[model samples]
Target: MVRLSRFVRQTFLSFVAVSCVVASAPSHADGTAGWESVKEAGVLRCGAAVAPPYVMRDPKTGEYSGFFSELCRNFGQNVLKVKVEFVDTTWDNIVAGLQSNKWDLSMALNDTPEREKAISFSAPATDYNVSFVYNRNNPKIAKGAHSIAEIDKPGVTVAVMSGSAQDKAITAVFKQAQIMRLPGNDETRLALMSKRADLLADANTTNMLLTEAHPDWAVAIQPNPPLAQQEVAFGIRKDTPAADIAVLNKYVSEQVSSGAVNRLIKTSVQSMLASNK
Candidate 1:
């Protein structure tokens, strides 16, 4: 009986020792968090595409400033404790940059299935309701046409920003339209204002901003139900460590819940509008 009791005690003690060893070791065995590498590199390479009010880059100064730019700076300074190096990218090639490890984080990116194959997105950072802006005097279609399908007929010029989710969305529903791919919102707006493009289709923010600046145009949005809801978020490579994804998503949710993100958005929009004056 004494020998049996000693054996049982020894086994219990061995189990406790193994548990302690396992618990003391790191959570992951092989890979470090992607942000850990950023910390080690002393700078988080950030992708900033020139989507105004969302991301704006100064060419001469190599400076980035906008809602997403500030938010990324906050993440680098407060969360990662690293400097952020903004790399200018275009609407179409931004996901490619992330997939190729050119940037650690994308400032503001749309979540789509095509992009998901290359990179993973954080929880939604913001939402954009799609709208269509067009010249009221355009003679191609009825002025009373409301639905996108009504304007999807051939010869209707739809100006879309290349490499944008808007480009995809418009192309999907307007198969017969004459789709003109432009580089950015500014150019797309110009196409619509100059009557070269019959329709400027994109997120409400861009369309509304352009409509406000150009009073001659009219916007059509389905008020009872939105035409499309685009969720904008930050993106990282698919192989990014789970811990880093958790940390980034947590930080974004925290900022959103605390209303800081909304306030910053208002400030950025106001700043952009004021500058256009």
Candidate 2:
């Protein structure tokens, strides 16, 4: 009986040891699932859309180089210490990709209500106001037009990219203006350039960048001020494991406090504008 008891006790101990190992293995696996993918891939796959001064592809170089892209690169290399791989995406699809876990983060975006439901945002990287840009040659739209209501008339055609803040705001304020929906910033700019549209509603920073390139083609209008200023942020998956979010938050906070964020915005915004020329 004593020998039998001894054998049963040893068997139970062995089973307990195996169980502990199995449980601990999953904790390690869980940790690996969060930030590990970024580290293993050696790159943070960032979803991005063209936003001109803020973010855009270099026409000549065919490369993603803008203020927003630079911000992501800084975060990845300097803060998170990871490589950054930019994935060009439409505004419509960027948020969706985050939900599907297709991308690690969005390079730059406005933290709107709908997006906030599915993704998280870091601290504001930049601030911008709404503005209108018109073909310089046409010169129909003028300064002192503060809102869409002021500029949008029966004959005027306003072009805006779908899924952008300008699109939403124009829809709300310029109900009378013939609203033309385009897929991306490039298309919207083309619409204005080709005289297919009278005015292009875009962020002030974006308009400034465009004006820099096509000095003779397009210009920024003002009502002696801008429509409104909104913050730009990096969008990450809402379901992102807490560990990953914590690291990103820490990095962003540090960058913001140190003013590295300001330098990136100033340098990259100008560089993007210069590249257009």
**Across residues 1-277, which tens digit of lDDT does each residue of candidate 1 receive?**
1133423343344334323321121212232337667776788778887776788666578777778888899999998798878987888888887777777888788777678778887766678766788777778767777777788888889888898888887777777889999988778878987889888888777666666766755755442256557678898878865556667776776777799988888787777777668
TM-score of each: 0.83, 0.79
The reply for model 2, stretches above 4 Å from the true place, is 1-33, 59-61, 136-143, 214-217, 223-228
- Candidate 1 C-alpha error for residue 273, in Å: 0.9
Write one digit per residue (lDDT tens) for candidate 2, span 46-101: 78888876777866776887767877777678764788888878877878877676
- In candidate 2, which residue pairs get closer than 3 Å at backbone N, Cα or C atoms, i.e. clash? 144-222
Location of the lowest summed lDDT over 10 successive residues in candidate 2: 20-29
Which lDDT values do the candidates have, in the order given? 0.73, 0.70
